[model samples]
Target: MNQQNHFALGLITLIIFLFLLGPLAIIFVASFEPTSVLQFPPTGFSLEWYRNIFTVSAFMDTFKLSMFISFLGNLCALLLGIPAAYALSRFDFRGKGLLNAIFVSPILIPGTVLGFTFLRYLIVSYSLPLEAALFIGHTILMLPFIIRVIASSMANFDFSIEEAAMNLGSSRIGAFFRVIIPNIKSGIIAGVLIAFLESFNNVDISVFLTGPGLSTLPIQMLTYVEHYFDPTVAAISVLLMIFTAVFMFLIERLVGLSHFTKR
Candidate 1:
């Protein structure tokens, strides 16, 4: 690209980033305010808000609930996503395009539709546990992302490594573990991380499925925000953002962000 074009592109990108992050930046800064109401350019700063976060029994309970649910959701997505990805990447069958479309279309479907569809199924036919329903619904939402990540990784991996391992007397499972896995480790790790993140941040599905005596952090935050608008929510938002950033940073350091791409 020419210098002028590059400069213009950079300016546009900066504007976009600022637009996206400005509200979040304001929330983070206001979170430390030593006041009752959420405000910007605070009169003072203190750790009291975070301390208050710890004292809230509801926040702790909801945080744990979110962690547990996200874990289960990611597990289910991986169990189903990995094999489906392998099939789509490694083997071609009749109606392959149709099957692939069905698998991935969930990603394009709106979260509201996904939530309402699962809610209807649970209410009418299955009558499944709310937690299980949430798990399944989140899997529907996140599974496509996982499968696509894994498949993209698989595409970039050379199959000859697996063939070589098999030819050298490794068992099928052994070859997969010792050869294929190591080669595709980055993709799998990225998929798992992204799946966990998507599952963690889910609201639409969880909000619909959650009943009395159960709530995730996002639901709790939504409820809390509805009832009271204040810097406490901002405190929680900053904490959540920090936690996610640190986690993603660790993963990127270990696995390398490049691993997430087929290139």
Candidate 2:
């Protein structure tokens, strides 16, 4: 019976892995197809679609925009979230629950609703630029992840370290920078990478926020698929998969991925 149970568990695990990775495997293989259209079991293989990704001006432009928004939005989220997380973890304050709820509300809300709300209240009412709106929207979307991750990292932290630093002539701010920040470095890095990934791959919010002369790579990919059907998008997807895998691998190397699961 134990052997039978083990076989069943192994079968389920194999199925789960295939379910997650099947489409990506298909895309990777289809990307090398010589033909313009994406298809499985290619008759011929070539790098044409991959080369086409670079030649397309829209892809290039939006790729840069996506990178810019992702990096900057994650940066802003970290700047704000670190302090916010520290406060929530360390201090007792009135409305702390309410503030925590507000911080996390973005992730809880559906992306479509969040996007429309931002469009109506933040963009239309304030008359903000598309770039500014995109930045703000992405920043908000990133806040929950950043705050939660950093706060989780701080859950097991020893406050006495900060107290000791303060006792040794470090100001509260200096102690935070020198002591607290270093202790939570792993979480901070993980949060930034996760936030960057979210902001970069965002579509529902970005679709609403984008306008002429401003677009993200995911948005561009959507628009591209609307006008054309080809392996170019597949090639792009494959490249993005590689990029994300590399990014996560680096994060794991810098700070073991287990850090997130632990605290």
Global lDDT of each model?
0.83, 0.91
Q: Put down candidate 1 lDDT per residue, 1-263, tens digits, no spaces.
A: 69999999999999999999999899888998888888888879888888888888999998888888778878888889888887888788999999999988887778788788888998557999887787778777778878987888888778788888889999877987787778777778788887788888888777888888888888888998888866888899898899889768876875666765533
- Candidate closest to the true structure, highest lDDT: 2
TM-score attained by model 1: 0.90
| Candidate 2 local lDDT, 53-133, one digit each (tens) | 999999999999999999989989999999999999999999999999999999999999999999997789999999999
Question: Distance (Å) between predicted and true CA of 257, model 1?
Answer: 4.7
Superposed by TM-score, candidate 1 places the C-alpha of residue 229 at a distance from the truth, in angstroms, of 2.3
What TM-score goes with each of the models?
0.90, 0.95
Residue 184 of candidate 2: its Cα lDDT?
A: 86
